[model samples]
Target chain A: MNSTAQDEITAYVFAVRAALGDLPEAQRDELLEDLTEHLTEVMADGEGPLTDRVGSPEAYAAELRGTAPFVGGFPDPPTRPNPLIELRDQVLPVLRTADVKVGGVLGYERASDFGRLLRPAWWVLRGYLAAMVVAEILDGGDQPIGLLPRIGGSDGVALILLAAGILGSIWLGRRSFRLSTWPKAVLYGTSFVLVIVALTGFTQADGYTRDSYYSNVTSYDNPYSQVEDVFVYDAQGRLVTGARLLDQNGQPIHLGNAYCYDDEGTYADAPEGVYPYCASKAPFRMPDASDAPLPSPAPSGISPSAAEPSDAPATPSPSVSPSPSK
Target chain B: MDTTQLLKGVLDLAVLAALRDEDGYGYDILRRLRTAGLGDVGDASVYGTLRRLYNGGLLTTYVVPSDEGPHRKYYSLNPAGRAELQRSGKVWQGFASTMDDLLRERGTA
Candidate 1:
């Protein structure tokens, strides 16, 4: 027979087999034992298309069933009651009803149609989740999972695996319909586990993001969280060392710690209530003794510029806090 | 009258009777039945009936290699099948005569 005729016979046989799907596999196969040879004969005898000659394949299978439907050659063995079959009998009708009802709500003819349309999308996602699962297994749970799968801290390995996984998944998903009993069962079980993994990964990611956002809000709420020390300065911006800070009601207010970076760069305690406790950590440079002579005899305790009138602005330090009044 | 509905009742009998004189392949048997004036007999029905008879131990099959295309599977009736044919043929004749008599009495023959 020609290739077209051959194709026609194959398609006809497939349809007939599908129509007979309700029958046991062995019976169906037995019934179609000579289907291809018979179809080829029919094609050779006729001139038009196979369907035009023999009616539709489905009708053909039905007519075949009408004459002498299959009788199993062997007496049915005493079979143990299968719980899965019972579960299927219970669930299929409910699922079919839900398919229709859900389809109506979603404005489709059937929910299964919507699901069919989303199958390719699911294939892609299934691939990503599979990659994640593989990554976890390879790492032996020693590494924390991120949104993307990384194997041995290499993005390249992860990328290659991800690509392979997605492609392989799509291939399997497309062909999964053709799988036999046990392989299909394995496929379904794997998909179920992958779905759980995807959900868990998403939940962890959400929590991590929420916690970081909360920390940002809490730290911004209080502006003085890291205010360690305060230095007073005049309108002239001169370093006002040893100046006392008083509150609104004549009460001395303490702000900075008494310990500071000393002259030798060591942390040491200074006397309490002394504003500019460390001279080596002054915020501004002062005039030399030759440039500005002190009128009063207090050069050792305070700089000559500190005794001078407030005439200039002081410099700013990123680490040191300016007086709140300033 | 649609002979297909009528053929449905006796296709098993027809298929068995076709293989009574000579063993034939599915397509050949179908052609024989068509030539015998059961023109509406479906190919699938004949094939399925042959399988059922074979499964029921009334028919036996063997494959013949052919150069034209695929190998042909030819079916032949066993002694049990021949006996069944005789029995069903008599029952059909009796039923037909009774129906004919009733029709004649009703003036619709």
Candidate 2:
């Protein structure tokens, strides 16, 4: 065979080998040798030059390969599984649905667990500090005296509690309780400073006078007013009627016939003819003749006809009087 | 009784019968089947049957190498394969004869 034809034949044999890579090496080699012999015989049978009868190398190789046995000792056909058949026959749709649900639920659980384990303490402290700084920036320098009272007030105490909580949570979360002590201490210190700063802003905003500040921090009503007569205001400066004022322990106090006035000037008065808003079951309080006689009405410069009866409830008076005139 | 099952059972018989006299590879088997007027047999089916027969030890395999091109693997029937062919041929003859008798009686009616 010509050199060119031989090269083409070699290339064809290599292609067959590549295609049959899965076959055992010995079987593949035997097949290649047999094909070479057959080609030689075909060339010898031709009358003209080997090249003339063989034609182009590509054409001859094509003919040879086309004649190769594929199954009953023929060229091996490419085998592949049908995907549709596999999906229909082998995979269970219900199982896949179950898998997806389980996977989704597991993912949510993991996320929640991570948040619980690593987020709360750090987030609370950071949020608290950031809020304080924002307040200071908003307050600017308008009122410094107002800031002092807040720093010294219950806000100061709340900051300390929050700092302690954060340190405790961190210590509990650590593998070695001693490892994070310094960082925890630093966090507490920083939290203290932030709380003080925030309280200062609170004071500057005159928050001390606000019922929320007094109720939440001072555990008392405005010092200027009786606790039972204190009223809470809404964001719009309206008296939130029926919103009972709570003590530090979150209990309600009722004083008979008393009227509570909020910042908005809206007032809630006890029922008519009632003295103070006391929690007494009595229908109405009338003068108790059984008690010691009360002092007589003043006569000098006061007209007896003009003097009006007092509306104060006959119930035992509170040890403390109503707030002095503000 | 489905066409697919019917075709699969007959395919092996047809290919073996065609190659009984001549030693031919894939294309040769296809061409000879077509020439013998069995062109309905698909080329792919014949090739697959050839592999099945070889793997079953019924067909002996050899490669004829070419100087001008790639080698070809040739298939021929062994003794056991010939015996099987003869047995299947007898069964087919009996079935055909039965069918012919049934048709003849129907035609008479």
> For this target, which candidate reaches the highest TM-score against the unseen true structure?
1
How high is the TM-score of chain B in model 1? 0.93
lDDT (tens digit, per residue) of candidate 1 on B1-109? 8888777777778888899899999999989999999887788888788878888898988999988778888898889888888887877788789999999999996
Q: Scoring only chain A, what TM-score does candidate 2 earn?
A: 0.17
RMSD of 1: 20.3
lDDT per residue (tens digit) for residues A1-326 in model 1: 78988988899999999988898898888889878888898888869999998899889988877754443222224689899999999999999999999999999989999999999999999998999889888865556756667887778878988998899999999899999999999999999989887888889989988888768652575454444455555543345677665545656655567778865778888777667666566644446433553334532422324465645433232223453331
Best by DockQ: 1
What local lDDT does model 2 show for residue A81? 86
lDDT of each: 0.77, 0.52
Q: Considering every candidate listed, which one attains the maximal lDDT?
A: 1
Model 1 residue B67 lDDT score: 83
Off by over 4 Å in 2: A1-326, B1-5
TM-score of each: 0.40, 0.26
Please provide, for model 2 over A1-326, each residue's C-alpha lDDT reduced to its tens digit, 9 standing for 90 to 100: 56665565466556656765665786556445444444444443445544464455444434334334433322224668889878876666766566666657767434445445555565555555554454444444454423222232346744654465456545544533464778768766766776776676557566546755546533455453343442222222222234343345655445434654545666666653233343332222225434523324422421222233543222122333333223
